[model samples]
Target: MKNVVSYLFLLFILGACSSTKEKTGTSQAEAIEQQTIRKIDVHAHYRYARPYLSSFFQDWIMQAVLVDVAKEDSTGINRSWKQYVDMDIENPGVFYLCSSLVGVGIDDPDFATKNIERLKNEIATGAKMVKVWKNFGMVTKDGSGQFIQIDDARLQPVWDFLKENGIPVMAHIGEPVQAWRPLDNPMNPHYEYYKNNPQYHAFAHPEIPSYETIIAARDRWIAANPDLPILCAHMGSMSHNVDMVAERLDKYPNMMVEPAARFGDLASQNSDKVKAFFVKYQDRIMFGTDFGNYDPAVDWTAEQLDAEQKDLDATYNDLWRYLSTTDSLVIRKQHTRGLGLPREVLEKVYFQNASNFLGLE
Candidate 1:
């Protein structure tokens, strides 16, 4: 009976959010409109499965023009994000976070420059967005082995190009807090990669900037280009600090955030706080299920799902079950579980906020 009631309620909400032009402009209608969930999934990778995708298929993209709908379907990875563009027009559902690539870090900025030229020439053809991944911190290096953070002057042209094209860039800068070290702390989880792949751990002069420094650089980049709107990934690199994230969002009119993979922990810890954060900043939040990238061969089999679920399940468990529980679990990607978010706020966090940010109808 409880399950049935919940199902009915969910259906009701889905129905209310489905309509576009309202018939009667009643208060209920207005509330429904405001509450309606539209989503622009500002994250998800596209790859050329024709060649290089079988590897990163479990976790990233490989580069491709288009993917056959049937060939490499990732709906299991993102059940809510099907028909990437159709989601925007049909319902207040998940829209596409279309992104473009420019260069191969500082190593090939010349190539990146020419590549971007090609991109510019073809921007009108369907490149609706730009998503610069953590390539800067991971890729840029000088002869002295100095790393080029996102705000590096050489990359200014990259930012300028996006601004000129009128496409907002979702720049995911900085490695997560624990990507640099391997010690088990209350803040992070255990990962086997750091134990073996010493390179993944920042051993030498970390081309990858520190968490604080990277956020600073990212914020500075955003601040300098007031006109170039950037939806900073993982909460402006302050996913670790909700208060500061709120502060930054308040400060940057041109800035926004997407809850890519932090949903479970934050919602589990303080559901009410997460709810309040969303209600207060509903206009600024965008929904992003950090799925895609399924290299089944490299990642794991059913055996690894338990560990993986700690991270992936947080988005759902936190989004839905958070209304009731505050108990923490081992959340994914090395984050300590538990961030208790509210029900209504979860709805906004799930999709509505995303829709508004992307201007999806």
Candidate 2:
């Protein structure tokens, strides 16, 4: 009787476990049917100096599941190139890298050949795109001390190589338009940033190309490379004016824009207008956070890093909330309602567009 009772008890336990597994499986299937996971941040900055760890930013990588890491040119920052490559290698499905190359040798007679070979190596080793920074028109100067704009003829070959090889270019061509305005200007979203980083303050420099000039050069390059895909990062630096961005989107079919570090600009706009812009150009937009572990200017402590990480996550959630619901919310001291984007539009802006742009689909 004791043996029989023990056997019955084991059977009952097994039956209960089986029943729970069946219920869980059914619930999972129902959840999958209701919503599919589709999210990608196409313009993240994961590259850092040698002593790199993902202590704070790891949740983003895991939650977003797919992040495109843009390896910005270290030029004066002393970033570790190997760190980016290693991260991509170690986190195969999680990270896609867009490597950067400086313009130190645009005037070099062998600039085209040397850089083309180097670009080929980067591509061969899993680079999906190449990044070009604002140094061309902002700070870099020719032998005559004249700023070499993006349309400089000497850099044609580099563009041609990227075009011929079908590699995309990620262009961070200019500072925000507010960077050119007076620091005291209240409307300038970047007022605080420029005030803190005077080196990047266009008002302080005075000699750098005007905001219009920088934008013109960038547009000229877009026209020149009609076949190559270009990602105009930070909403092509026209986040303050969605109409201007819309005009460019209508003009350049080969170009796409990513909203990285420009959420404040979007949130400040009329929510209805912002929703319309996203709806109209859902296919041309990609989501990006510009989140990274290092900023050479700041001597970051672990505590600071933790705080930044939490803030970044919170801001990202706010962005999602803005798109996913119609609730009114305050962002950056402004009262604005949510865009209430549809699920299809959200899928494209969040994931599909990135997959198509990055060739990851």
Error of 2 at 65 (Å): 11
Candidate 2 segments exceeding 4 Å error? 1-35, 48-80, 185-187, 295-309
Shift of residue 314 alpha carbon in model 1, Å: 10
Cα lDDT listed for each candidate: 0.53, 0.74
**Reference-based TM-score of each model:** 0.61, 0.80
Assess candidate 2 and give its lDDT: 0.74
Model 1 per-residue lDDT at 58: 20
Model 2 Cα lDDT, one tens digit per residue, 116-146: 9988987887778887777767877777778
The list of candidate 1 runs beyond 4 A from truth reads: 1-36, 46-97, 102-113, 185-198, 203-208, 293-318, 323-348
**Predicted candidate 1 versus true structure: per-residue lDDT over 1-361, tens digit per residue:** 9999999999988876554123212235333433343323456543211122233222221111111121112332112223333323432212243634522335654855875785575455344566665555665455557666677777777677877767777767765555665456534432454555455455433555676776787888888889887877767656655787899888888988876665543543454566577678867776664654344335455555444544443343333333223444444443332344455665566556544554444
